[model samples]
Target chain A: MTATLTQLIPLTPPANPQLQDIRTQAAAYLQEETIPTNKNEEWRFTNLAPLLAQTFAAPNQQLPPVNINGLVIPEAPDSRLVFVNGIYAAEYSSIANLPAGVFVGNLAAATDAGLTVTNYLGKQPGGEEVFTAINTAGINDAAVVWLTKDSSYESPIQLLFIATVDDAAVAIQPRTLIVMEAGSSATLVQEYLHTSIPNHPYFSNSVTEIWLGDTAMLNHTRIQDEDITAIHIGKTAVSQSQHSSYTGNSIDLGSKLSRHNWEIFQIGAQTETNLNGLAMVNGEQESDTHSVIALTKPHGVTNQLHKCIVDDRAHAIFNGKVFVPQAAQQTNAGQLNRNLLLSPTARIDTKPQLEITADNVKCSHGATVSQLEDDEIFYLQSRGLDVETAKILLINAFAVEIIDRIPVASVREKLAVAVKAFKAS
Target chain B: MINPNSPVILSIENLTANVDDTQILNGLNLEIKAGEIHAIMGPNGSGKSTLSKVLAGHPAYTVTGGKVTYKGENLFDLEPQDRARSGVFLAFQYPLEIPGVSNLDFLRVAYNSRQKHLGLEELDVFDFDELVQAKLDIVKMNPAFLSRSVNEGFSGGEKKRNEILQMAILQPSLAILDETDSGLDIDALKIVANGVNQLSNKDNSMLVITHYQRLLDYIIPDFVHVMANGQILTSGGKELALELEAKGYDWVTEPQPVG
Candidate 1:
């Protein structure tokens, strides 16, 4: 550690006895650790020097009652939670008639006796990485979702975090913790939307921790479409028990510099994990995704596909690692990373790693980085589409491979339009 | 309307082209009148496929010296897509697989482009489905293939039939089949050839490029040209296919006395 992040940025912890231990741990780690540099293997392709140079402080202002009627996903969820500037804003939230056992509220407002937020509040399955430690130490309010055993919800739950503008560079940390007990199921749509705040470089440091018990299934969709001038560093830590299934669709379409880290672990046998990620970047923006899936038990199945479409002078990076320990016999794992470059200056760096200690497992990993095939464009052109139209069609085709996997129909349509508009520009 | 003395629809004079810095078409000359089917048969690597791609304005091929006239217009002056919109279609031997673009959507887009070119009304989804259902009879394909990605995961025979399906939808005046019978079985060959036969008319001409005489047995070409070393060595009638198949391609490449 070169320069301690805690000493550089002063954050005053709120007075909460239940969260005192977590706050103390976050502060200690932030003081002990320094910001990661390009020399770090995980930060090699992405340079954090520019972001580190900028001074960021939490935006201090009245929590704006931002109207999110236009920002919410189409066919809005029955239960919606909205947060502005990392603080819960109930004025802009709407909760449908949830079941009796399911509890959804802000972390700061939940009482110690009502909802237990101390155990899993800042504690993630993947220990505190550098940025996550910073976010945990700094964030005062967060969204806490808990579903008791045998509880199920048919309609998807929506969580929206809107970033309000400020005059100076501001750092906002929004934390989310979801706990699903055994034999429960739920669909979650977590989104981050940024308003066009002129001249303000917003830095959003967010963390999501999900724990699924035996026979539980959680469908998670995380989308980050912040302002182009913003910087976002998000983490999702997931742990699944026996016979549990976790499906994640992580998408990034905004921000000048963004990094998403997904850490998944199987604690019991016969668990299933499916992960699909799409990073569509243009201009000088950069998006990087690093996912690690560990199978600690037998009969585990994991399938992951990550795709990145880079245009202009942008860059994208993907690093996927699958670990199958000796105990994880008869494991089946597949990982594929594909990248498409639309310009000569665009770049992609992908690394898919598989560490297998069990000879009885079946695991495969592959990565490919290429521009659109000239033959494909010619093929479309020969069918009477002009050059520009043909290029757009092919570009859409490249994205559809990953977009089609998303379970939400409206979200898929929204992304399809964004892809077409990007091509036009 | 039954005029045997039809005007020439496509005339190629000294059509020389190169692909990947290697000359593939060397001063190739051919003239096709309206309502005529010309079949060019040669052994492998005889520039037969190159001729088909060059005519479709493939971006990779460079035309060094050639004058191609389609309907009295300089074909080189038109873009590849413009050429397609102007009623020229190429049935590819190896149809590229597009993973996400549905076959129905692709055909609709292509059909609309041609319809707009002629100032005709474009068909909506329902109307287009009705129109395409009628054209499916040309190849006897299952309607399920229409929803799948274009030629993706299709068998060799299905891909060729898809080409015929596109041909039926576009209804081009000059259609070029590039080795459409290469990997087809007997039943598939009959279906493909029958589709071509049904789509042929006095106003449109066909250029079938194949290696086997079996396909010619079904389509029955009017003129058979033997291409060797990037140039046509001889031209004859339908019987010429049988002669070439019996004597083998060696006769076309054998040494000949200089005039």
Candidate 2:
């Protein structure tokens, strides 16, 4: 049946008893929350008509083996989880020997002895969001990760979600849940790739929920490079305990339409958080980023930098919010959003907001949108570089502010190449 | 116009130009020949810098009248990049700071562009690295500077030296040093003078624009010209730079007696 977020999603009984109430709550929340329109302050610049107008059905198609041939990650040599059409494909997957307390496998093939996930699964900061609620209501299989106390993984854990060509106008809801116990550390790399059937208009409504215990840390990298025929809306929710730290680098380079939401909560004191993101779009593509950092405890610290490069007739939007309440005195927070418009027709809208009630805290937020300077162009041209090559060099520099932060050498190199190719196209 | 059969590298006659509705260069005339070094001395607002920019085809400076012949071809006809490829180089008074592009990579691209213009094969990264390191000695620059962004976070003196290093690599036939000694200390000035001296050969020429005579003392100009409003007020030998340095620009600003 053709459906929207307003309609009921049919699902079998929950195999894990813990998810039953959460699913019911999500269904009720969907009924109460209306889909955000452009009239809403948060969605002022981003029109969701292209996404809402599409008639979507269930994603049940199996994927072919074409995803594994050219896709590789040298940084993540330990394990690989390939999800095709939101289902785990074991034939194209591998797992190296893991530590005693570490578990790496499919989420649907539930192993009960691992760390507890029921406490964090489906628990997102914006559980009432229209798209997030839809993901909770429709998701059955997820890529889950768990590490026990005092355990650390040297190599990265890679999760690749390849959205296949769906016969129906379908929305693929792929969920990711990672839980780390006290004193544990791990690196997770999740890449969203789509092999689109032309003119299909597939939608990937994905969500990832992460929980870190006291003193735990995680370096998470998410790269979304969907095909132009696809609509990608993903949300990453992170909850950190006392003394825990989180570093994330989000790189968005593709998709006809994309909206990524990041909600971070510093529930415990003395936590540190860093978020770096880059979005490069061209043609008629629209990429929007919305982030929120809520520090409720004292002595929390955060550093965030988000940049965007809009070309052709594409539009990019950024909305960042940082909240430091009275209890979070002595918090230090900073946020900046920089945008580069490559053409006269390209557009960018940015809003960086801060709500701080703590008198002793220091917080700053700003946004800048500018075109390529003629002086800079002439400078390179004077050195014998043609105008186009000079623009590419400047564009690459604009993105390196975020791409250089990726610790994985292979991922960084691939992104550099992708940035160059994106400028040419 | 200077004779095309001779070795004149640049000839400017009756040049009139402006930037933003303000006339800077009016009826400026000069002639430069190969194997000759010309030093232009002027006060503040005397069109010294404008002359260099107009010669290099800066877009901001509009030439209303007059003409410039570079290597016997119309200089205004070529784009700034083409002018660079044809061996007309300008060391900016304040070089631009380009972040995220390594200095070595930028120099290599620049060098290869000139080589390609001459129909020579371009060098690869390894070969270019070796060549760039050898040229760094001219500026007394450290190899570590190559890994940094082009002129980004560099000291004022370092930026000037990088400019000279580029001049060494490009080996342009007509090089204009515009206020290259503006923000340098004694040691940096000596290094810059030494680099310019090394690159100055009989086959090439130079135009040094400066307000002080300290730079000329080291580089030793073949001819010195005093510029007042828009044109060269007086022309003489190297001793003229020492005369102006001692007497100040007041002598040049005043109307001179009829010859």
Candidate 3:
């Protein structure tokens, strides 16, 4: 593990002095930290033995040629930044449609804006975690979006990461930083995908940090659709200021084994946070989602709904935590986790926790694990649909509740098709 | 609408059924001619709903004995969906609330299945929408219901109206109303009955199952039967429904002196 960590850090330091300092500190932190095992409480349901057994080298900087037409979302055609193997691909990126005071480009480009980014780069909490530290230790470039005060972009801005693996196993660490100044608003879509048809095994470790200023609103959508043979571990950390609103939508559908860590902290009062997540796994795939919502001030509002559909021998795990301390009076929070098992052998472990110390707060949480109801299937069958069609309709209905909330039209249509194709193996 | 010359549309001979190891239907016998509406009045636990479910091929009920023929074909031989496509319709007492499935799409798919069974070309979205809009007027349903999920969050009156709207679209040869008027008010009952009356024709038959006689004032059945212990205790003209209403369920279950 030590040898693999050394190979991930680039020998040549970045030109930006601020990033160089971050890298050196992250390297020293890694000497004391190690990869987490199943014995850890946070990773009890997720075994990383498959990931730790193999050694992975950093991907080369050379960009491979591939068709990206299918990955395009027509709603955000002109404001897109494409990254290949954690490196920015300039030939495929377009920023002609962005308005003034909106910066959409790589970290190197954000460095030219003079110290505006340094205040938020690698500044979010939870940087000491092993995977996040690994990403910071090898941080060379990142996808950065900086919205100035009172600047609003009408269309969505897309950040797409494509991983292409060759014969040898490789590791790629992707980083993203989004900063919304006071009264600024924008819609952002972040997607991760693999280009290889029969993909070679690879590891993708990624970290994303978002900061919302006072009264700012941001709609964020994250999609992870790596290859079936890959391993993906991701972290999304968010900080919201006074009266700011943040909505996040996450869809996970790929990887043989994957885990997502979502954390949200309310730094000011009267902030609102909404989160929706869906994970669909079949065959031998395993997926886990761990989320934490912390409210420190009064009058904060938060709602979270996460669902999973497991089929065949697949497994899914979910652990969600919501904290309302003594200072957070009059806070309203709700959390729910719903899971569907399509096969008898499919497994789901869901735990929803609420820690409330404030007497004046309203909080509720529940978790449900269920199979397709016989009554539902018979109801559809009685309306002239066969059993197979009935099963598909019910499954699609279960998933459409989350998919329909997506703001993008083409993305919703694409996911609807993928959901309809789900069948028990 | 009953005529002696019309052929028998449905015939049930000593039908026996069970649900969850308990017998619900015990040797029930009935026959209906074409263009006739027959009303069955019974007390609770008399297997009135079970009879409808068994006829619709619900998975929970198993037919332990006897036989039922629909238009000269064995009803139990076909699967539930095939039976539906072959002109059998059951308006449930409690319609299912399927979230996220649009009402218009569900109607179109069910209608297309019947059309396909009859060897007719299927209608596209525009034509089907036009047809469904015309049918919606029969039940006095608002066009907004088409966009909402099927029966989800609908009031009792709205759900019953939606069921009648489906009946207007399917136009089945044999329709079974399993306590359709259970939860509806008088106004909604009239609307549902009006929709059913419009769909009734010389080639179709209906079996209306209910506990009250108020629904009969609007529907006006050609025949009424008193059911007790899963068997037809007595059969008579439409006046039987009024008599049952006046005498209550005790008159049917009591042992009367020979007369």
Q: Number of the top candidate by DockQ? A: 1
Q: Model 1: per-residue lDDT, tens digit, A1-425?
A: 43424432335656565666776787687666777878899888887765777877666646866657677775545578898878788877776566676767777555542776676677666656788877766656778778889998777788899987757677778889898989999888899887756557888888998989999999998999988889899999999999999999999999999999999999989999999999999999999999999999999999999999999999999999999999999999999998989999988989999999998999999998878777888888788988888878888988898888777788888888988987533
lDDT per residue for candidate 3 within B1-259, as digits (tens), equals 8799999989999999999999999999999999999999999988889999999999999999999999999999989999889888999999999888899988998889888888998999999999998888899999999999999999999999998898888888899998989899889999999989988898999999998899999898999988888888899999999998998989888887689
lDDT, candidates in the order shown? 0.86, 0.86, 0.90
- For model 2, residues B97-121, the per-residue Cα lDDT tens digits are 9888889999998889889988988
Residue A351 error, candidate 3, Å:
1.9
All candidates in order of DockQ, best leading: 1, 3, 2
- lDDT per residue, candidate 3, A145-195, as tens digits? 999999999889999999888788889899999999999999998998989
* Clashing residue pairs in candidate 2 (N, C-alpha, C atoms within 3 angstroms): none
The parts of candidate 3 lying over 4 Å away from their true place are A1-7, A15-17, A113-115
Off by over 4 Å in 1: A1-10, A15-17, A65-67, B5-7, B250-259
Interface RMSD of each: 0.9, 1.2, 0.9
* All candidates: CA RMSD (Å): 2.3, 2.9, 2.2
Model 3 pairs whose backbones collide? none
Docking class of 3: medium
- Candidate 1 i-RMS: 0.9
Residue lDDT tens for model 1, B85-200: 98899999899998889999999999998898888999999999999999998999999999999999999999999999999999988999999998999999999999999999
